[model samples]
Target: MSRYTRYGGGDPLAPPVDLAEALDAIGQEVMAGYSPERAMQEFLRRGGRDQAGLDDLARRVAEKRRELLARNNLDGTLQEVRELLDTAVLEERKQLARDVTMDDGDRAFREMQLEGLPPSTAAAVSELASYDWTSQEARAAYEQIKDLLGREVLDQRFAGMKQALENATDEDRAAVNEMLRDLNELLEKHRLGDDTEQEFRDFMDKHGDFFPEDPQTIEELMDALAARSAAAQRMMNSMSAEQRAELMQLSQQAFGSPELMQQLSRMDDNLRALRPGEDWSGSEEFGGDEGLGLGDGTGALQDLADLDALAEQLSQSYGGARMDDVDLDRLARQLGDDAAVDARTLAELERALRESGYLKRGSDGELRLSPRAMRELGKALLRDVATRLTSRQGQRDVRQSGAAGERSGATRQWAFGDTEPWDVPRTIGNAVRRTAGEGGVSGRVRIHVDDIEVQETEARTQAAVALLVDTSFSMAMDGRWVPMKRTALALHSLIRSRFRGDDLQLISFGRAARTMEIEELTALDARWDKGTNLHHALLLANRHFRKHPNAQPVLLVVTDGEPTSHLEPHGEVYFEYPPHPLTIAYAVRELDNAGRLGAQVTFFRLGEDPGLARFVDSMAKRVDGRVVAPELDDLGAAVVGSYLGSRAPSGQADYRDWFGGRGFWAG
Candidate 1:
């Protein structure tokens, strides 16, 4: 309820502050191909809906379109059609026109000058003719047409179309020639097939500059629009992927390159500014600039959260509870069919994933994790957990013990051959006692090495942890996995960013137990119910920790299932639910090894009265570990405490995690 995408007043044509712009900024930046919805969200977060210039442009375009709709047989705004035609022309031609043209209308209408007519007159004709239908001479001949039109009106009329068309396509450029033919056909009929004066006027206003008055046909109008988009498409196809990406990057930074990206960027605002569903009435300069080479249309998923708006509304019913009931399918369903994604959106997401390192395609054409993406997911969790704990506490990396380098302190009586800070009183007393006693120092009162034992700092014990999460359907079955996943990400982020010195491994177990690279976390769509192999997960985790003895080894297992799978040496898996004895035994094999390695096994169960309690309790005693009950939002917090130690509630000896890890999730 806090967020609504307003139809805000804005400069529809200003250079977009979009994902490309975000990526160019310093620090962690949004990558290219970010979800359009996310892109807009981030843009708004940084302050969008603020450009008056674009708003003015949109209004003007819309107004011009309205005017055209009132008079011409055209289909779109002046700027829209001009922009479309401009797309048909070479970039070199656009530059030439911009160089010569001054006014926005002139620059936009310059495409009409393709006929080689004077740019000024051609632009004017394109603008006026786009909305009305009448021969230059015939219309003028109607003096009462003059009386009907008014002196100011006649003056506004464009110069002549033939004057430009004769030379514009004299060379018969295949594309331009085809366009000319279509225009000629549309003009030959009634007001471009517009039966009503209003429709005719709209058509004229939208395409008067380009379409001939002689041919009035609806097919022609459609053809013209298609040709323009086609031309743009062709232009894109002509370039290599690298070239296109490079050009896109450069164009997005239109302040510098201004031609390609800047022009494309303006298209959206320009189109919006026009007559909307009507014809081209806006001035020529309006839509053609594009500002940046990126296209308009806001992409299908421009505001993805919008697709989830209904779900968000439904979620509000949860008030302070039922948060765990949130469903991704419901979120997806929130979108109406028209706004749903297609091939284009998928390609965009894939590109973004590749750029973000979330999806990598290997030689075998399979999805794999890139190192950077993997690191990012882990880093995300690490940061989340660290922040959660540190707000109320201090950095808890680790503390060294007195085992390494013991410090020296003197005992009472000084003995010979000992290094110590001599205690005068104790030495004197010892001498006096010797004079008066049976058991005392004889001649020289000196401290001996045996009596003066130096205290050494205990080597700070390091903990090597392997986090095993159940990826089986059952975990998500209880609708707890996302929080679990987030918990994992938060924990990973915390360790990497805050506890830079800790050793951590991330592993998820389902039918198979294997270590996952960090990049795979976000894109993971685990098969929820394939099988929950708690035994295999633990075994793999234990094997990983066995290599590191210097560290206090531990297994942080996040699951909501009992043992279900174990492997025979031959590589086949044996899976049985309801606590199969073989699976239980296999789990014990690893739990027992963990106990022998002196590593504790901390169990994290996320269900009410979990059936696996007895099995867990037994394992806990075997390794002297503990289990935590996770509240929905407390998953990350609980997991964090496993590595970071916590103090007792009682005002007694403060038990720290030893290493400076925030026991954020300390249970």
Candidate 2:
């Protein structure tokens, strides 16, 4: 057996929305100092590789509105009536000319009646309603004018009535009048809050054939009626004063009865009372040669209203805006299903990002990136670094799996340059066995170099690492701010994930220096103060090193300028331009202190200023460290490789050798 269900209606073959792409883009912006909320909104506004964004949808809607207004005018009904009246008069004159049997006085009277008609089409139509025509074709044509006017007036409020009621009989007209009476009564009851669902259902059952929209409830019915009525009113307002006056007079003669107009007036009043929020007062100006009948003109106004609504929803600029506020059904009706699909995808992406725990509010109630988000962003940055390294190193494998200094449960024969602890029990056992196998066992078994054994250890070293980044305004002005953040995040990810035993500290120095977490550092915006305080940064790094006394100290400094600020003994910051002698002395003294702490330091210079380079080289020489001036794009790889090289044992291959000498200073 098989089962079936109604189709939900979209392209079944379209690819699912790519949330990863959105998340990555949002993460990048967040790292560049955008709040999590703003970053996600920016992503939605820009959309993904294959999806249309909000801005694109808004532009298309505006174009459609402009086209509608420019291509139509409101004179179709009046023009049609005038043509019919001219044909009737021409046929009557021809009949009078051929009728020799008629009396001369009667022919003259008929000619005079045709010649003395009013200038306005509606007035002429009303005056001719009582005239006795001599020609059969003339009488039929004159009658059709009233019929056409009635259908057009009805079509304005009830769409499709002009086509549906063409050449309708008196019974058809009576049924329509009865339907209008019942509809007005229902709306009046609804407005006074005295209507019930059963009454509405009964009303629909009586006249349901007239409403093809198949509204299921009273409110839906009211909404549809009210919207059509409002569009009709706006269409009338868009017409010139002369057109408006003519149409108003012609409407009173609809179906050759004044009763129809009175019922329609009552319906309009009830709808306005019930649905006051509709755009009843709105109007537009149309300047074109193509004339639209009352029905078509109302439809154009409705389209314009829909486009305006879509533009507002797509803007998402109002207070407390959300993607869910967009009306997908309305958008599809106006701009097709593909545009609706694009907007739906964007809304889903936004909802997923907000609910995925990737963003959280800090204590201050401002949105911030969560730790999980930081890890994700860090992983992406690390992958980019790996790709850069692979390309620059000619496809060499530069993957490091574990930390150093953890002991494995195995023993190996000692070799030159081995720093592992000696396996004393294994060495003694090997000596005893060797002596027993060679000859009789001596009272004192001698241990020989061949019998020496050392404990084999896994690479699980515990090291204290300090990554200091320059955060001066110059960094942002020179396009180095984002790269600096990326480099720090890459190294931070590497240590936290691959080398769990390593301790990492991120410190930023501008007018001063302070320690921060990875998320904090990534979200830190550049300050505009004018100082590069390497002295303050070194003080913080030395403190971190002292805290992790037993771990190997590794310091990586990234800067583009010489020292311009120092801390005084009284705990105040002293800043000066062009490197004050006292500031340089203070910075150099801190470097010497870091050297005494046994830190293997590396200076990753950012720019090509000769004076700054010379000063950094001198500082590196004092600490027996290395200085690498890599390209901005390669900064992450250089810092990460230097860190790995610092952790390598005395005789093992390091990241520098693995990277194939890609501008790393091998000290």
Candidate 3:
């Protein structure tokens, strides 16, 4: 065993890493305009810890290996061997022809030596090995071929083996020979079913220095060795018949002995028999420089194949596929432990979001929020608003009250003056039981007036809420777009969930004003139009109030700028910068109309523009409304708090007092 193994205890594997945080971070970056691919790369580059990203690294390693194979000449060594043999044979012929000290017997002997050349390269090499060469150059060339063959063969089995064997001593060569002998013996024993864990351990203990990967089990060792052997076979398969023959002959000269070649051949056969699943017959056609060698080329092709499989597994863009399907072990092998963890985490986050119905792919192959996501996002925003409100109000929980009062949760017989909604299920159930008890009346189950049940509710005033959000280009340019949308969603959620009796209408104004459904409003992207038509927004709010004349009108306006445009008689927008006089007049006229309808108005101004503050303050005063200049972060809370205050017993008076303490609004 190595000294490090003797001194060290095996370190524990790292705990699984969470990828949700990373996914969320990357998603936010993507939403902010970065591409998903680029965002993920940046996340990894910044060392953003997660799971499941090793496929990318594996692809890079595969590419690097390919480049190494393309640039380096692997087959040059074999060519050199053939050239050296040819030179040695040619020099022998020249010596025989030029010998002046030769008699007829010597001439005959030299002629026989020249004529006895073997047809096969291996036999030729063997014959030349035994010959007493007359030329020193021929002898040196033949010897160098043997040394080169040994280094090249070893290099095919192990990376950097050739460089390590450069200028090797006799001791190094002996060690290599011993390693090969022991390796072949282990393979033979394994093939015969006589190999044990202890035997494997003993082999590694004796020759551990040669393998730095330090595989723990015999299986791991076999897998490693089998892959290399298979790749070497594939390398030969990829070469032309002539090239293949030359290489096979040259390999026999490895270590200057046929024994090493025989041992390796047997080992390859044993490995192939034991692990038949390996791609031993696979071959890749490399189209680069002619100097491409068989050593790194096959290994790189194998890596490329692995990378392709990993890439397919890691791709999350396929139809209805989630990240959970990725093979974490393969990912770790390709990238690292951290990448696997990241990928796993990302997969989990996707599964969670998908299963929970927060995100989904649209028909256009783009990710968009589902209806559930919209509701969830709204609730999350509302929670933020509630927390902020509670903090400001000395941690007091805001009392949620409906204008139509709380349900009594009990059923009572319907009366003529009862304004409560009917309990349909209970009423129908009572009618059914009565019909069954009456007996023989089989035509229909008649619901009598006495059987009608109305759910009792406390008496409360109903409210009509209109949320006006500015979606002009400036809102997005000034970075208030998302916050404005969030505020509207929070207020919409607060009313729908806590004040179901109240009617809510969403109005977005940019060059013109229009009403939108809650879903439409939530998913609406910021427009690049150049208008903030508050006049048209208030006009819509007044129309909504008129539709529900009995309900208290609550007009909540969220904007970052003053009115810059107003609707004309022909339905076209007349836009002008620097506060158009007609636009101001049109806006004031709408605010007056809203005031006449008893609309409780609140303007949640987003920025600190002096002109906006002056206009909003004057507008609030003119219409007896509230003007709140809230920081962007507090926009949601401000809107929600205003709606809650408006729903209180004293209505606008209570809202004024609530904001009075916070100094958020001027009457």
Candidate 4:
């Protein structure tokens, strides 16, 4: 082994900042690797370009590939080679049977019709039929697909199976649905997704064919994705729990002290003492039981974008039911007069919940916020911010030097904090290496204008926006909880990472209102005891902005419930479902205050409410705000749009995000 410099891996020795860059520089290396995420992350963690940095990496890779090819006299470039590899020519040859006649020998055969084989299988068979098994193409073309597709799909009923899985015949969908329902019901009863092997076998015996027989865990999902589109799958499976948690915990440990740990310990005790599965914890009233079984209570909304996914994950826990709640309390539930969750798993869940800060007390006697939870929220926001700022969509480059246009007049002589943009490449090289080996830049090294490019800065005013989410029970009426939570997570990510300067605050209202960190938003969907507290939400937002008056203030309200809770003069909380005068009055007052304070209020209503609309219409007249009736998927874009007004020019606002990279997410 000569001194080898390995490059390009999904879990690259050093991951690139951007996926594209990773593909370009170490893509070949990535193809050979087992852990793409690990390789890519590693590549990036080593001073690699983030997603935005990919373009630069791409250019560099192109240059490097060209240089290497010129030195080696290789044809085309590395990418072309990879594309050829993807063709599966060799594997295709092996599956096809060779014919001695000219039709199959000298002449290139047309597409193979494995009358019943899958398209992929048919293609594989065609190759084998086109040449002798001894041919290089046949030898190189591995038997991978056939092993995956199996004889039924390949040798016998390939076409039918493809059509069945593809056309999604009723039987196919039914199978999947039944499996999901079984999982969902189990979750409704238990909190886990697995159980004894025999029980698993029975469930699988019923729905095993719905999914692939092999690779049940999330790991399989990654493999399936990679097999389809190596690049996209690479995107889908960006980080692992181990990596994310590692980074998350490291960051948490750095931020968390003994006080924080104690604060974290209190959440479970409060939850357990409140009676099992009851509204005693005040979570249900707060939209806690939204999509996921946590019910969207103390957890945030961004976590569960898929109720189906949540159900599946929790089905293991759902294997049995707890008798502590009202439903099972009567019979003491069969199975020895108690079907309660086993102490081992219950304690495990409790520990996880507490350590995660969903349940925490710390020095506070009541269930407030946990430091660990707060840290996660902060990290969530940070990750969200990183993604938004690095998003490759709107913005083109990450060259930040404040000024963008001609560098003739605007850029002055080198001044403190003024970046060298004229010769950007050099500027970055210098700046990045400045704090390297020897200490600092030597003034003796004269700088020239060529070494200066006024790093183009997109001029846009920053805004402070607060996303006020409704914690009303109505929003959770149809199990719309998953989408809502995912929306929050995506939005926070869009705002913080993309528009770092823009101030983003999250507030939820049910009985009372509270400002939550980004991490808190993910777990908020489980809050179930819901009644709209629009007034308090607005009031809370108004108060939140008062602390940051200088920033452009805007309120983005996401609600599916009408005003039902509002603060009263008597210091008592009031609740009314259909349009309460006091609630409406309080909501309007808060809006009026926002208008006076020059804040734009935008509402994305999930459900229809005449009173809420009338109130919004009433408030719109006084203040600059917009209302949009939105579905869950549209939340991320809508909030991002509000942040970047419709009339705003090319660079009015920009959100750049680079996701699932390593070290950034590593412990």
Candidate 5:
């Protein structure tokens, strides 16, 4: 085996970063009111790793190809041959004139030769090689031309060969030949499926310096070589017919041997047969200023091709496609290790969302939030409420009042008709202490009715909450759609999770009003209708109050518009703009009925519509309700605060009195 010396220092490899952090960031954005699509785009944009670098590589490749085509007219080696010939001819004339011993016949012959030369480049090159020369400079220049031609042709097949073969040596040629022979043999064995992993290892152990990519498997090595081979073919395809012929002729002079050309041709054929999927016929137009030869230009084109593939894979926007479909290895090659990490993290996040039951497919074959997701979203909203309450009240437990539900801090002696659960730990401690003082003989301890202790629990009043959310087209157009849904989900979650005794009904009013389950409401898309039927919504709230006559009725109305529609007899909807008098009367009549039923009404007014403000204020006054105009960010907290306040003791003047007349509820 020939010893090979590799050149150039490459970049140092860095440790891979975790992708989970990126996924978490995306999820947090989604929870904070951004759609999943928008959140993913934002995360990628700010996440530091992008396709910008790949785009730069693509541009460089195009520039290099253009540079090669622009200078295609003049071959570097042929130019050198002409200049050396001129110098050699001039030096010969100088020596003949200085020596006075030269005959006239000799001088005449040389002058004729110099003056009358072949016009064709190939003929001139042949004549010059056979000419006799007296000057050593002329001979050395001629030799250098041959070496340059050989190296240039080899450079067309291999990148970085020009630098490596600058001063040609017999040993370097031998080493190259050996490496090519071994490579071809390995590829041939691979094609036949007769090569083992150890065989590949042994081959690389002997000639590894030639392949700097350090491929670990035969498949990897084949892929790398196949890409380069395809690029070389593409470079030829991009050239004009005349340029192609000239390049092929020049390639024959590579390494000053026909054997080298034969070996490369065999390697190319083997690669094509083994990896036929490569883009062998693809070509790119070059219009850049940087000069690059055919080999370097082809390498750049390959990089650009890889980058285009990476861009498509990283987009993650195809039909029926998910993050898991992204190709991480290809991403790492085109962008960097960080991009691969980010992609993997996104895939994991999507899988987590699907597998953990946070997201599920609906009957329409679209991804929607599952019931579990609604509960989680609700919990998240409740946590936010707790945090906001803590910030204002300096930290206090937000507890729900229930009658005989759980053990309380205070205890009383067991009484008849008392259904409160006993504080087992405290009851046992009391019994033990009493028995210790009595000094009872030890077989078993006796418990009398007088010794039993029971926990004292407060009786909590059950409230029936009907949440009326305006889902008109205006809410979505004005960006209040998400906030409204969030408010409803939070309130629903609060009632169901904290106040088990409360009956919560969700009623959405657009052109009409209807009741929806919690899951249906959470997965509901924005409406595109124009009417806000507050009257219909109010009518539904009154009916709900009628159904649960014993429970305290609390109507929470969230809307961004005044009553533009109402329901008529026979289940027909009447929609109008500019405050219809009949619609106002219908809405007021329903509110009065709710008020007559002793329902607590709270109107959450969204947006800055003056007409809506005036109407909501009038309605609140009519029904003895409160009107709250909170900021979009504070809507959830405001609604939850009102709900908690409604559940306060009946003697409290209003919901505002429960919060000490501070915070969002005071408004």
Candidate 6:
């Protein structure tokens, strides 16, 4: 046997939404200085590779609305009334011409009355109400006009009433009148807060056939009635003044009596009082030759209302907006189930991102990328960098593992901060022995905390790394701010995940320098300050190196300008442009200090300025380090490669081999 599930609620066969893609896109925007919430919203607005975005949905909604307005006009009922009146008059003239047995005076009088009837269809119908029609066909046609008018008026408020009341008898009309009276009474009681569930149920029991919507409560019933009533009013508003006037006059002649009109008017008033939120005064412009009857016109207006609501939902621009706020059922009704599916998928994507704990609110009550989110984003960046590195230089032996050195023929109990490879066989054996000695009977051997073991290895030296990035206005102006942040994140991920023993410090400098966490640095906005301040950045790097005196010191500097600022002895930043001699001297002096501490320096040149190139070359030569000139796309790969090369225990020889004379080094 087979069972079926709804197609678009969510298809089990469909591939899962890619949250990594969303986080990666959002992280890039955040790195470019967007807040986390805005970045997420941007990603959702732009959608993913296989889905439609909010903007596309909104465009479709607007087009649908335009199509509705261009396909309809509101003169159908009036046209029908005029046609009936003309036919009745023609039939009456034929009957008079054929009545040779009647007196000449009487025949002539009837002919004159027919010829001198009022021009307006409503007026003519009213004038002929008392005239004794000579033809049976003419009399029936005249009566049909009253029935049609009555049904059309009711249909405008109660959908399908026009078709249901066709050729109805007096008993049917009387039953409809009774239903209307009961409905009005119920609405009045509801307005006064005196209606009960049983009373509503009793009304539904008597008139359930009239309302196909099967509203379960008084409020639901009122909402249904008010919405339709408002649509009917809007249809009237969209008509010309003459059309509205004719409709008003003709409505009084419905059912050949004024009682139906009186009851309908009372019901409309009660509906307005109960559902005051309905847009009863709104109107729309419809330009088309095809006419819509009262019922169809009201439906078109309701469609317009739905389309307007859809437009607002798809905008997602209101305060505290969420994708869940979109009504999927209404969207399906207007745009089809495919659109609802698209909207539902977007909502699920947003909910998943929020519930996955990747984005978290900080102490300041603003959304920020959590550490887990940073790790995922960084991993994605690192993978891209690795792909670029492989394509450019061919595959190299750059496998990253926790254990750093060659393993010794010895095992030790595991502890915190251990990076050695796990001894799985020995650990399992210890678990089995410990469990058996503790009198534990089990089908599967259980591993306890005290039974875990790790393979011993020779000690490998760890590196103290400092990455200083330029954050002056020029970096942002040159379209390098995001790439700089990406490079930092990729390097940080590599160090944290692969080289667990290494110490990493991130420092950013514009007019001054300060140490920053990776998250803070990634989200730092660019400052339009007028300084490079490499001297201050280097001072911070050297201090970090001093803190880890026993580890290899590696400094990576990314900048596009010469030194234009320096920190004075009083800790105040002094800035100057045009290569201030004192600033240059201060920067060079710090470079000497970094060299004295045996720090391996690498200057990643960002632009093709001849002066900057010359200065970076001179500086790299002064420290016996290297300089790399790479495009923005390769920034992450270049920084990661430099770090890997410098952190080798065999010193500059291993660093040179890591590049394999690939000409990555500019000097």
* Residue range 100-178, candidate 4, lDDT tens digits: 5445633344223222333332333433333343445533433322222221111111112332444334454345435
TM-score of each: 0.42, 0.83, 0.56, 0.37, 0.69, 0.85
Q: What value does the lDDT take at residue 212 in candidate 3?
A: 71
lDDT of 5 by residue, 1-667 (tens): 9887632122236334344454455445654556544554556535535323223333433454455455443233444545765677677667666766778898778778766776644445456666786667766765665666566555555656767788969998898888889989999998889999999999889977767778999898898888888887887776657556655665565555778888889999999999999988887665544544555656666766766665555554567666666666666665566656556655655566557665567777665556666676676666666556445543243222234443324455666665667667767777776777799766556676667766644445778899999989898899887777778877887667556678998999999999998667655667798998998998888889899989999999999999899999878999989879999999999999999999988999998889999999999999889999999888888888777767755423232222222222322
lDDT of 3 by residue, 1-667 (tens): 6454331111246444445465555444443444444445455434344332445554555665476456654366555666888888788778777877868687788668767877666667767777888778778778877877787787677655777887777788888888989988888888888989998999999988777768898889888888888878887887778778878876877878777677678778889988999888877665555564445655555565565666666554466555566776766666567656566655655555455554566676655556665565565566567668766743333222122456735455676766668889999899999999989377688899989977654335689999999988898798887677677777877666556788999999988999997656655665788988988888889999999989999889988888999988888889999879999999999999998999889988878889999989998897789998888889888888888777666443222222222222210
What are the clashing pairs of model 2? 403-459, 403-460, 403-461, 404-459, 404-460, 404-461
Stretches > 4 Å off in candidate 1: 1-384, 390-459, 497-501, 646-667
Prediction-by-prediction clash tally: 123, 6, 14, 112, 0, 0
Task: Give the range of the ten consecutive residues with the poorest summed lDDT in model 1.
Answer: 148-157
lDDT of each: 0.46, 0.85, 0.72, 0.44, 0.70, 0.86
Q: What is the lDDT of residue 416 in candidate 1?
A: 48
lDDT preference between candidates 4 and 5, better one? 5
TM-score of 4: 0.37
Model 3: weakest 10-residue lDDT segment is 658-667
Best by TM-score: 6
Clash tally for model 4:
112
* Model 6 root mean square deviation, Cα atoms: 6.6
Per-residue error for 101 in candidate 3, Å, reads: 12
Residue 489's lDDT within candidate 2 is 91
Q: Candidate 6: count the clashes.
A: 0
lDDT ranking from best to worst? 6, 2, 3, 5, 1, 4
Q: Mind giving the per-residue lDDT tens digits that candidate 1 earns over 588-652? A: 88788878887766788777755677767777788788888777667787777665552112212
Q: Comparing candidate 1 with candidate 5, which one achieves the higher TM-score?
A: 5
lDDT of 6 by residue, 296-410 (tens): 8999999999999999988889998999999998899898988898899999899988888998888988788899999988877877776676566443443222245745345
TM-score-based ranking, best first? 6, 2, 5, 3, 1, 4
Whole-model lDDT, model 1: 0.46
